[model samples]
Target: MSVTVERAVCATPSTQRSLLPVVGSGTQVPLVDGTSRVYANLDYAASAPALDAVAARVTEVLPLYASVHRGAGYLSQVSTALYEASRQTIARFVGARPEDVAIITRNTTDSLNLLARIVPTGPDGSPGRVLVLDLEHHANLLPWVQGSGHRTTILPIGPTVAATLQSLAAELSAWQYTLVAVTGASNVTGEGLPVADVVALAHTAGARVVVDGAQLVPHRGFSLTATDADYVAFSGHKTYAPFGAGALVGRRDWLDDGTPYLAGGGAVRDVRTDRTLWQPAPARHEAGSPNVIGAIALAEACAVLAALPDGALAAHELALRTRLVAGLEGIAGVEVLRIWPDSTEPVGVVTFTVEGHDPGLVAAYLAAEHGIGVRDGRFCAHPLLVRLGAPGGAIRASVGVGTPGEAVDRLLIALADYLTTGPLARYVVEDGCWVVADDTRPLIPVHGLDGLAATAAACGPTVEAASGSCRPRRAAHTAA
Candidate 1:
């Protein structure tokens, strides 16, 4: 699906507004040339700006926030009802099966880790083998390594998406794996996986499939029943809500039969010195006061996204992706990265490398000169980055409903300027980072965190301020 959007050749915040309303969309930031510009946030894949609706939802929930479960107070009962209702909303957002249970989690990583810790042993009484592609993000790949009854067989990605599917089929036929875990989309290149087909392959081979939907849920329509995947995990931060809430929606059998993710408070039905009886499924997994407001906000985000006119969001983002990719490719020194030649654009995450510029420096220059926020590093998919021949790192510009066309145009212009005439401001290495010399931009004061902003400013160009993705300096390996 694609939508026709007017293209702009020059950079300006007034060009066009977002398709969906979001907080901090028109916020201005100080640039190095004693001028300020509207902050163009092109790093949606990392953490999307909060949707206006989600913030409102949070505000509404905060007053109702009281102790969850076992409370006689009116507010407590209301909060408990809201928490469980939010779970149902989350489940419905992904088109979960009636038997599926949505467990509240911190993020996708925490969800995956929880499942990993509880996987049941196979009939052979050993941790069975799991099949996975090399292209998955660390959140998807690393969790399997720690699964109690599973060891992963990392399959090398093929030359094409078709070949990769065939390879997965072959791998499944050759081995009796217990599970097949895969990413819904490649976080590094935005290449979506054929999840329905993958689910079919895995189920045909008698293995359950887990689709990491951290990247997919934010951009496209996802239905677990349509795909027939046994499980799917996602985070609210990537789904247009703020951080602190995520979900693991999947079959109830495994979660009910397995060990509880946590063993405190609401998790147990009866507790004594000698014995304990754990609750089932969601109650078994969730065992604390919980993030009442975060869950409500996340549910609000999901409801809002699910109610959009069919294909509206997908069309808007893919259109932006096409324009951004073409513009970047048109540059002389910029090389847009892709995993499969035949893979169509799934979301708007696009990574590229400049011929003669350090990724960190390029990101810093963009922040200092253009007020554009982009990410530059391995993106926590170190394995994928290494395979793409960008072990050092690369620049990534991801878009969402909050992004305007002018932001994309601005990024292209900034990159072209850097490639052609170099950075407008002088730069020198400070604290092992390439920072604008004598950057005079005053740090914004964050309430209650007195001197924290200034302290960060004193430390020249922290990773979040410059690259927002500078990773540990080390050899590329099979590690997060």
Candidate 2:
């Protein structure tokens, strides 16, 4: 039986604030007419904004920051202890078995790639084949293709959820697959898969299951032990940590026997000039100085999420999702993508396209005119997008703990505005990206860049001159 946690009530505004503080919730952005509005980030499916609690944890640890598992100094020992303790914390949070190992990685992609390296090959000296669904993120798909030395069979999604499960069961029974890799939720549609059912089917077929929980863990509660999944991978960025850390938690036997992921300092027990003895599981995988802060931040996020009253987070997201889906369905010329239309328990991700408008243009207009940030692309799931008949891509709006009902209303209003009046300013396609033509808003610094002018100047003279213009053009208003 699937272990069910107690579901918490939906979060009120005050409770939402207490659940997790997020960065950039009140950030301002300027529209084409030079008026600034508070930015509404609807792109949590890509990367969520950092939680203020996570930030505070980092700040608390910074002063004592030092190399992990390396130095003998006081700070180093503290850092090392915290790093190792974080492993246990994360594992416990995921409901891992006592024998399971938790290996820290850079992100979900990194974690899956590491697993790819360790997955055992078949007896004939050929690599084992992995069964994967078409609806996987590139992080889950490409690693097995490029690194696992395995032949992957991409299973087509059925028209309905039941049909999809049936297909998986049929395939598992027919093939001697080494692993069954599946996503806990569809990143594109936010539809939660029946992970417990998938696990049962895969296990009955003598295949181990790996769940790409990058999207699921943040929105719903999951237990690896309860689900009987062999492995679970997720990223901290998507879970409101925003630190450069992720985890692969699963069975220890394969990881312990497999070659170390990185052959460096901390991975070895004793090294001779000719040969070296490797450490067990985690230490073997983590060969160098670890991302101590990132790991701690991820653990902090896990702790916070775990402490949330049973279904509080899920309840809040579900309410927002209902509003969003209903609002979008009410709009003309808008089609919301879904793998299973009858699914009643989807997360807060919604992908759609407006009739007669390019997805990129619609996304640009939302940002440029409405200060609403959304993602428009194949979402790194090109095959799924193509399969869904969105070869040109679509718009994705995903919400999280930080998202408010007002944000959902704003998105609906913006979409309605777009349908009624279209974009107020002309858009131009530059280098495959749709951008506002002759935009003059001041540039926002990102990734440690000083300003847009500095970045442009670093690129070239023509771009530098273009970046210097910030005088606003006349407002172009359209009747709504």
Candidate 3:
């Protein structure tokens, strides 16, 4: 199963470009030096660029969008049908059994939080104990600690992957744990874990296994039926949909028996002044108006990925990963981070650091000078980063179906240039971030609330005056 870097180096350029249709394949961006280049996006691990097919499907569904499951109009019926069909599409994509249910969520974090709410308490009416490894994203780690009727036991990873599995077996044998949450792959190192093995061990110990598949699903295929995992959670954005949807697919017994995740209109069958009766599995958890468009977009993405010729996408990514890893290893002072050195299975993610430069500065330099996008930070795995002795974090370059081999070459060339001659432009610490000196790019908002005060000021007093006078107006004409 191990493909050497030498074989990947021999792959033709055309073979790399035929991998998948990425949204921003040939997008060009201007660097700080007043030079423009086609952007090289190596930040797929954080949020992958949407697939062109997914975008097209979304556009096609927008004009017909309407309220789902609560209206009798034509568009409503269409939307409702599409939404439920999307659930089945995703369920089949994960190889869910007939009794399993797929619950639409906002993202992996929301899905895990919903599971945490439904996790049954022990005989003492207290939270049951859940086991997790140190190598988890905060999305997977934090939910178990917050409202997850479970006490979390954070286990440390051993020196090797085999040893880590052995440790998990030992821990499970020692306790009557209720559940075991693990990641299908490491977001930091891109190393695949033995998920099937983990599920077998947990099941033998009378515990259910939940996998955070946000990082794994995009790169590799999964089958809940084959693995016998109790639950799998993943984000649509990470899986090339980028439409603000996620899914939690698993066995239905616990979810059907527990209270609804959200309490609202669609979740309940009958509402009274004193008592209310909730609905069944999927509907019970989905309370308010759901994201019909996002769900359809996610389903379309799964269909497109599933339709790819067998082993085509995986082989393309492997070639790119091999080239990037081998190139990084050749550069002096570049240390590649890894949890398992002997593990050859990875998903096109590589993290590294330069000896004399900060990871943030290196990442900024790559973008400001070379127009190569990369992620620099702990990647939301703070505990794992602390254990790896990288409290400040490392630079991560992740590839996907649409990633071209030329982009990998550009990153390698940039890193070598940085190590040999230092950054082309001087960087300074600005607001706790490394930025190129005299750069003249407008600051883009990271989150919706970021720079809210400044945004309001820029809108001026006229906006405030208009807001006071604005009123909801009735529709000019009613359809039915």
Which pairs clash in model 2?
7-311, 8-311, 21-52
lDDT of 2 by residue, 57-136 (tens): 99999999998786899999999999999999889888999999999998888999899888888777778879998889
Candidate 1 per-residue C-alpha lDDT over 116-162 given as tens digits, one digit per residue, 9 for 90 to 100: 88777788798877787888888888887764557789998888889
Q: State model 2's lDDT.
A: 0.82
TM-score of every model versus the real structure? 0.91, 0.90, 0.89
Q: Tens-digit lDDT track for model 3 on 1-480?
A: 121222223233323563788798888877876778899999998899999999999999999899999899999999999999999998888889889999999999899989888888776787788999998998899988875557889999988888888999999999888899999888888885688999999999999999999888888878899899999999999899999999999999989988789999899999999999999989999999999999999999899888988988788888888888888877767788988866667887888877656788888889888999998878889898888878778899999988988899888877766765667777766445676665543334446544544544555422432332111111222100
Which residue pairs of candidate 1 clash? none
What local lDDT does model 2 show for residue 125? 72
Question: Which of the two candidates, 2 or 3, achieves a greater TM-score against the reference?
Answer: 2
Cα-based RMSD of candidate 3:
8.5
Where model 3 places Cα greater than 4 Å from the true spot, the runs are: 1-15, 123-126, 441-480
The model with the greatest TM-score is 1
